[model samples]
Target: MNLGLTPSVACVKPKPEDSFAISFAPLSVEDVYAKADDPANGAVVVMSGMVRNQTEGKPVVALEYQAYEPMAMQVFYQIAAEIRQKWSIVTRVVIYHRIGRLQVGEISVLVAVGCPHRSEAFEACRYAIDTLKHNAPIWKKEHWADGSSSWVSIGACETQGC
Candidate 1:
């Protein structure tokens, strides 16, 4: 019955350093990067979401973000767990999202992933941000230059490419 088979040893992965926060203050790329930094990491990829000056050709004056804090934080943790499952080599995951009114060019969110390789770090970082955008209980209000304001749906991001 044995066909030259050997019992595979179970690989034990180190506990990944994960940080998640729902903040009212501004998000800093350097801060998140530092959180995701690990001695075992060869690369740390960071994605920073910012308040753009325009949306769908409309001039945007500012954006106001709101979130269900408790649930959003839970979702952030879930995202990190998912990343670990998908990329076992991931050393750390850091996600920070800012709420409140923000002017154009301001940072809104930061997602960073540390891994032993550049490709996995980049992929894991991208997954964190994209999943957060769709799954987190967060909302945004866009203020137009014409003094009109509209609340945006999270689903709109998929269709309108927001």
Candidate 2:
């Protein structure tokens, strides 16, 4: 079922063994991992991107994320599909991205990959995140304590403390 969700987000649970568990809201880091947890899969990899307290020597109080929801969701699916194609042993994949304001230390994105072995799981997880950062239509704005904000590309940030 599609859940009739906003086109900006994709929350699809295709199947327990092979699925792209995607979401575009405040995400539970633990839940993202759980989606890939299975006895049949011997290895599971999890990655979480969080909002930090500082960026480029400036004190960042919070972050505001915006996305072209429909395109972002499509990118998530594409990443997961690519993983499945390259790693046939992969049992599951979950990619969750958050939007709107996020406080320091809050999770902004999560990628979990499950496979029959540790190496494949790790590789798939890494590829999923890297691809998302480069391909996803998501943008972030750093909110500094000095009452300033700047739009930054996800993978092109030059901040020292980001």
Candidate 3:
């Protein structure tokens, strides 16, 4: 877990057996939601983004994801910062997004937010995903049946369900 936390920001201490749980992984939901049992985090909001097998009514074979690492990390930090600034009650926020080849139903991204209040957690969680879609510099290539692949250049405005 490359938690790039700086001294300027609040240092996140590993939850003491009861704080909160948030995760993203290529494995399974069990691995991702291991912290759900934390008692301190009363509310847990989980969001999973999956790769669809079909695109534009076409039969998709596979997908390849690419990301500009530096920019993507910046964007991820920005989203987390925005969520914290916008909400006063968000306790813990976890987001995991993958960059590589993917098949249908593969989990592309996962976000989880824990807070004392359910409303704040929900708002922050949703905001994180929406912002990531709009800001992350990640691209995808769709493979078709005939061995042709096309890139999906998702701009900030277009990706946020705009």
Candidate 4:
């Protein structure tokens, strides 16, 4: 947990009705944003991860995301707890990541956090997305316009569990 992430502790999958969530079916960022909105919480930060048209100057046609759902769901819950512990003002955290072929400009994932103030909301929101990218059980495969395909693991995992 040195990297400001939650320790990988065993926990039940976060419930559908819980503040922590992960959805595979394409869910709207606006919907997740609405769920995190609260008059009591002055700040609501939403992070949207989109499939870009290129990577490192290489033209990308699409990306396919696949994950071990059980493990990924566990990590997502752990991240939510970590955010709450680090920033007690955070009232809600919602994450939605898509698994399948995604075209350019399509949203690949979304993370939203509600907090009493802007600072905590921003910090916790960034932490959730960064940690998920670094530690989740998801894998991304890039499809190039030239018909080349490659599985790219996150840099943080490339030297470890990968």
Q: Among these predicted structures, which one has the highest lDDT?
A: 1
Candidate 4 deviant stretches above 4 angstroms: 1-9, 12-24, 155-159
Runs in model 3 deviating more than 4 A are 1-28, 35-38, 155-162
Per-model TM values vs. the true structure: 0.85, 0.81, 0.74, 0.87
Clash pairs, model 4 backbone: none
Clash pairs for candidate 3: none
Ranking the candidates on TM-score from highest down gives 4, 1, 2, 3
- Model 1 over residues 97-132: C-alpha lDDT tens digits? 889999999999999999999999999999988888
Q: What TM-score should be assigned to candidate 2? A: 0.81
Lowest-scoring 10 consecutive residues by lDDT in candidate 2?
153-162
Candidate 4 C-alpha lDDT tens digits along 1-162: 477765354785553433544456676978989888877789999999999999999999999988877767787888888887799778888888888888999998889998889999999999999998887878889999999999988523553564
As for candidate 2, its clashing pairs are 8-69, 8-70
Q: Give the TM-score of candidate 4.
A: 0.87
Model 2 error, position 56 (Å): 1.9
Off by over 4 Å in 2: 1-25, 155-162
Candidate 2 accuracy as lDDT: 0.79
Candidate 1 matches the true fold with a TM-score of 0.85
Cα TM-score of candidate 3 = 0.74
Scored by TM-score, the top model is 4
The deviation in Å at residue 70 for candidate 2 is 1.0
